[model samples]
Target: MSRKIREGLLMLISIVLLATGGTILYRQLLPSSAVKADGAKSGGQLSVRHAPEPKADVQGRFPAQSVERYAFSQEGKDLFSLLVARYQDSIGLPQSAVLFPKDAQEIASSPTGLRHDIWQSAADIIARKAPENALFLSWWDDGQRIHYLSGKEAWLRKPSDKTFVGPVWKALQDSLPVASDEERARLAQMARWLTMDSEKALSEIAAHFGASRPVYLLVNNDLLLHLAEFTAYGGTSLSLDSKNIPAGNDLHGDIALVKRWAFEAGDGNYLAQKEGNYYRVWSTPDAKAKNTLLVRLLPFIDSLKKLPKGVSLVYQSHWGGFLSVYKIDNQPIH
Candidate 1:
């Protein structure tokens, strides 16, 4: 070969060798699933599972006496029992259903210790009370527990899901009392769309969910208590406290003034003291202030007691009222 040609050939071979080594290294670093045809990440993506068929036998396991002491009311007891029974059956231990702690003090002392157990209990209730293919509507936080523990379907598994960007999510966001009059009006309209006892609104929601799957509204008590924080901060990372409230903001002064006034005024709508460092304040029944979605939703939730003819409060429990299930009796398409 000519000297120039030999040199050029050597250069080309070196470049080829370097490129081959780099490609091999890159593939080795990539996750197994990432190299798949679908380009999914290994163990990083959630797998969608088929909804389980409802079982009639599961209902028989829950007895009112079993959960009576754990619950506050007869309805609460029955619901609690049903959830416990459901959880027991779900884990393939039909004979060993989990029950609430016999001593209420134990729960009060260490609520955090029982958090997962509580979640599992709530999941059981959802699994048993809701239909086989029921689609639960609730905040994204509870979606995973309902899905993995209960084997039920949820509208959105996480807040960042694209499905959260539409009217329903917007309505929920607008439902917060922290906005303009026009915004509040929009919020009111949306609240009515979901929670109103009107046949038309109920029908619209049913249509939104479609005919094949029933829609169950799941309300977590903790979610209701901290709704203001959720609305303002979009998560539990922030709370309504003196430290969290920005300096010069009206809310800080308002809360302090409300706390002072509560000592004299006694319990009323505008201010009330909670068990711990928490306290609640609102502008008035006629005019709700910003960051008070929880306060606003409370009365609306109470109104569920007298639901329209077709709607029903299927379940409620005492453990912080941790779970409330509402069913809209719209016929399923399937």
Candidate 2:
């Protein structure tokens, strides 16, 4: 695990986030000026007024209609509705059926679906460019995909007795529907690897997955929305506070109402939202939640200035910049 991975073909990452075409202005925030004393500080706690605008350039930039489409978009809604035509009893259509043309277009409009291109792109990289017999580790979902498409070995394929429940709450998430014992202890450890800070997380990943072959970690950008879902799994304190404002007659009033919620930017919190169903903002302004592995891996949505240590930005899809691959550095296997 500590030895250097046999030098494999490293596919340089193409910074093509704006592939859909739009002026991408990587904002340069005035460090101290990004926040101002607007008579907003209260009880030694910071308020939105202290930092009225987003402190960092977040990934959920209210996606423009013509650009990238997610499962939560209007188009995604229509595709998902069509995809779920048969499965009336439960949400098994996506699991059992093939991802036809609709899958490429984004059918699962819930918080978890992404354009198939990202996964396919990463798979292509591993299949065509990466070295043979290299080991890949990731959240089980993408890990299984990499193994299948790339023909590479992905660790922790399936966790048993696990079920997911997704809800729409003004960008906020609540407890999922009851299910049989959801034992995701190992998967929870993977989540922890993503949520842990750079230093510790790097060591942990190497210890658990490193070997003579190269170990690559595949991550999707959509996990930014999954912040709340895996808190219990990773045993982290970070929280994603969400709020959705349905387009209504009370435009101004609702707009003002939208501003009120668990939002505090000075604490290094960013806001993201879904404009299709609602003016839904995906926000989690936890002052202490900035430097997790999840945030650094997917800078497309979350607010991380740079990628974490002990990982190299090996590849990124040229089509839709929704997923990324990282080559883990050498570390002692504990």
Q: Which portions of model 2 show Cα errors greater than 4 Å?
A: 1-114, 164-185, 243-284, 300-304, 318-320, 330-334
The CA lDDT of each predicted structure is: 0.37, 0.44
Scanning candidate 1 in windows of ten residues, the lowest lDDT window is 21-30
Q: Each prediction's Cα RMSD?
A: 26.3, 16.0
Q: Candidate 1: which stretches are off by over 4 Å?
A: 1-110, 161-203, 225-284, 287-305, 308-310, 330-334
**Least accurate stretch of 10 residues (summed lDDT) in model 2?**
21-30
lDDT of 2 by residue, 96-198 (tens): 1111122333322322224444455556667877777677777654554555455576664443333232211111111111122342666777777777775
Which pairs clash in model 2?
59-301, 71-109, 170-243, 170-244, 171-242, 172-242, 269-285, 272-282
Most lDDT-accurate candidate: 2
- lDDT (tens digit, per residue) of candidate 1 on 21-95: 110100111122211111222343211111222343232323222211112111112111112222333345322
Residue 150 of model 1, lDDT score: 70
